[model samples]
Target: MTKLIGALDQGTTSTRFVIFDDTGAIVTFHQIEFEQHYPHPGWVEHDPFELLDSCRLCIEHAVNKLIKLGYQVSDIEGIGITNQRETTIAWDKKTGQPLYPAIVWSDVRTQNTVDQLSKKSPKGVDALRSICGLPLTTYFSAIKLRWLLDHVPAVAQAREHDRLVFSTVDSWLIFHLTGGLENDGVFVTDVTNASRTMLMDIHSLSWSNESIRFFGFEGIELPQIKSSSCIYGHIKQGALTGFAIAGCLGDQQAALVGQKCFETGTAKNTYGTGCFMLFNLGDAIPPVLSHNGLLTTVAYQLGKDQRPVYALEGSVAVGGSSINWLRDNMHLISDHHQLNELAASVEDTGGVYFVTAFGGLFAPYWKVDARGTICGLTQYTTRAHLARATLEAACYQSKAVLDAMNKDSGTPLRALNVDGGMSNSDLCMQIQANLLGDGVLVTRPKMRETTALGSAIAAGLALGVWKDLNDLDKVNKEGETVFRSQLSAESTERLYSGWQKAVTRSLDWAEPVDEKLE
Candidate 1:
């Protein structure tokens, strides 16, 4: 029987099941996009049941396709899961019913919750950073969990009854995949997912009593933290029943692994709905946290006995989503591919700068109040310029993050491994290369299904398909393209300076106002 590996890539907007051969080539896969609920201006949510159903459907569909391609279901070695981090879900442990909708990682409904927590800490928002390596922001899972406990009565009631189980999307999927209520599903999360919860101690790789006490989470059951490439459990019910649930990782960290960035100073920028750049820090825990606006997170832990690798991550709130906004909201283009064509039509942005701070700026500038702004717009600027500016917005933010990463590590990245939706655009990658200047190279792989391949790699390692990291050198290393900077340093700096000025205009644009008459 030909052995294969399966990966479940549960992302912010869609869920996909991919099967990969031994050489890291994609055999068969299925993807399903679910609804995204926007109840309020800044709130984003996903139905917990819908998320689970999507995963199940993706597996069934993909497995059927695999069979059509002359592969038995039993040929699959194991299944790995990679998910969007910090999207908190609470459920009744007894009945396997969700207490509330999953609060997505991008939701900002907890700004007031953030304020309340900051005031209680003597060091303000920076108090927990030393312990958890994350600031007290609305982005982390703990903040979202706190909001659910405070606002949702069902969650509080479950906690009171000692039936509450809280975890990220990975644990949620694992719980059900391994048999939810009937089979006593495994309740565990990996180090990568646990690190984003703001409840785990970064140095110790376990749940912190200090963080739990600070958050006042007394009665809930937290998932046991494990290594990224260890068997959590066996699937009790699925197309691939009896398969080992071997590996798990957050999506961004999975991309880091997929890009084969195992060495220190190696970095990758994933240009998805949002842009995330993670610089690998190897196996040692940092003595200090980021002074720049980057997050210190666990990159991966290959096995239970292996040491954890760390990373410095910088997040940009808007990337390819800006193109979506232009297509959906502004009606600038009917299709996303047109964005590249239109952008290529213009020589440049015509001195225009767009700050895409739609839901507030992330990384280096944790400004929750910052709104989107377009500077240097004039009557001379046309739709082509706006389209070019839209692409430039993401590249500029990435440059900002890369600059911060260089400053914090004191070691500049020589080349960036690029992937995700926006990286498909040759124009966008070229723009990114220009913005990054001559010192850096941007490389994109021909096989762009890297997120899925990453999870498969983890599962394959656990199953002994490959002996170690050294064996993965040629896994996804075919037909690679490298882009070098084409613009002069002086010109790049001038464009970046305009971006900085535009960002300044966007800051504090959404401050709350008291409506009461004096």
Candidate 2:
């Protein structure tokens, strides 16, 4: 009987359950996408119940397939979870019902609330950034939690009755899957997820009292903070009952761990709906590290014994989402896979550059007023030219983040481990390689689902399925494809410089845009 690990990946757009053998190969896998709601401009949400149901279905389906393949349910040594971080949900502690829709990380409905709060703080809005390593922005759970407390009637009612339980998506799923309120469900979140809420002290690795007071969220029952890798609890009942539920990381951090970025300066870019570039900073939090626009966060905490590993992260608010807009909105590309072909049809963008500041630009800029802009459009520009420019937009944004990471860390990245949907496009990857300039290599794993595998690795380590980090080296040893810069430094600079000009034009395009904070 070969033991296996189950990884539950709760992402922004979908939920996936993947079963992995000890060697990190996928035994079986299943994924189900959930609804993404936009009630208003700059607002995004997910039905909490739908998120839970999707996980259940994925798990059941994956386990059934595993059984047909002759693997016993008991062969699952543990279950690991990686989730979209900072998607806030306030639920009834007793009934297990959400008070409001889960506020997604990308939702910027709280921009006005952020502005109001910033004015009240001493260092203006950035007062808390020093403590939380995040700017006062709508991208975190703290302000979203504050907004729900201030606005939602049901959430306020739940709070009055002492039934309000606050959680990120990871905690929400863990609580329900481990028996909800009936079996005294585990009320906890991993440090990686908690770190994104802007409510945790990175150094102490606990909920910050000052932040709680600042947000006026003193009474809600927040989840206990746990290390990224450890047995938080067991599955109370399910297809795989009594399986130890160990290992939990926020999705990007899971990618970092899955990519085996154990040493400082190792980095990876996850080009999902948005892009996140995490440069590992090891155990010590550097004193002089610049938090300017970039965020500092927990990369992972493998066990209680190991100190929490940290990373300097630069987030691009629009990555593959721009590609999504092209397919669904513009109707230019019929499918995502066809995008590469369209992009490759053109020699260049015909001097066009796209600044995909859909909601606003994150990382290194933090320009909340920026909106999408396409510059240098001319008579000769075709759909293929626009397609090439769109791919360039994603790559250029990543390059800006990479440059910032190098400046802050004082060490340049030699290579980047890349994953997610856009990494599948060879043309896009080549563009990324070209724009990133010389001496940097972009590598993609054969099994692109590294986020799920990272969680599985964490769970396996906890249950002794794998002895240590080194023991799992051969897990995903299938050959990898690597891309290096083909463009000269002078040409890369000229192109990226034009991208900067396009970005500047997009800024403040929607200033005084009414914020629906009330």
Q: What TM-score against the true fold does each predicted structure earn? A: 0.97, 0.97
Off by over 4 Å in 1: 513-518
The best candidate by lDDT is 1
Task: Estimate, for each residue in 1-518, the C-alpha lDDT of model 2 and write its tens digit.
Answer: 56799999999999999999877788999999888898877889999999999998999999999989987888889889999998999989878888889999998778878988898888876767667777788899999998998789889888898999899999988888888888878989999998899899888888999999888887999999998889988787768778888999999999998888888999999999999999998898642346456888889999998888889999998888888899988999998877888889889999999999989999989888899999999999999999999888989999999999999889889999999989999898999999987889999988888899999988988999988888977887787899999999999999989999999999987655354444
Q: Which stretches of candidate 2 lie over 4 Å from their true place?
A: 285-288, 511-518
In candidate 2, position 405 carries an lDDT of 90
Error of 1 at 177 (Å): 0.4
List of clashing residue pairs for candidate 1: 293-364
lDDT digits (tens) for residues 437-457 of candidate 1: 999999999898788888888
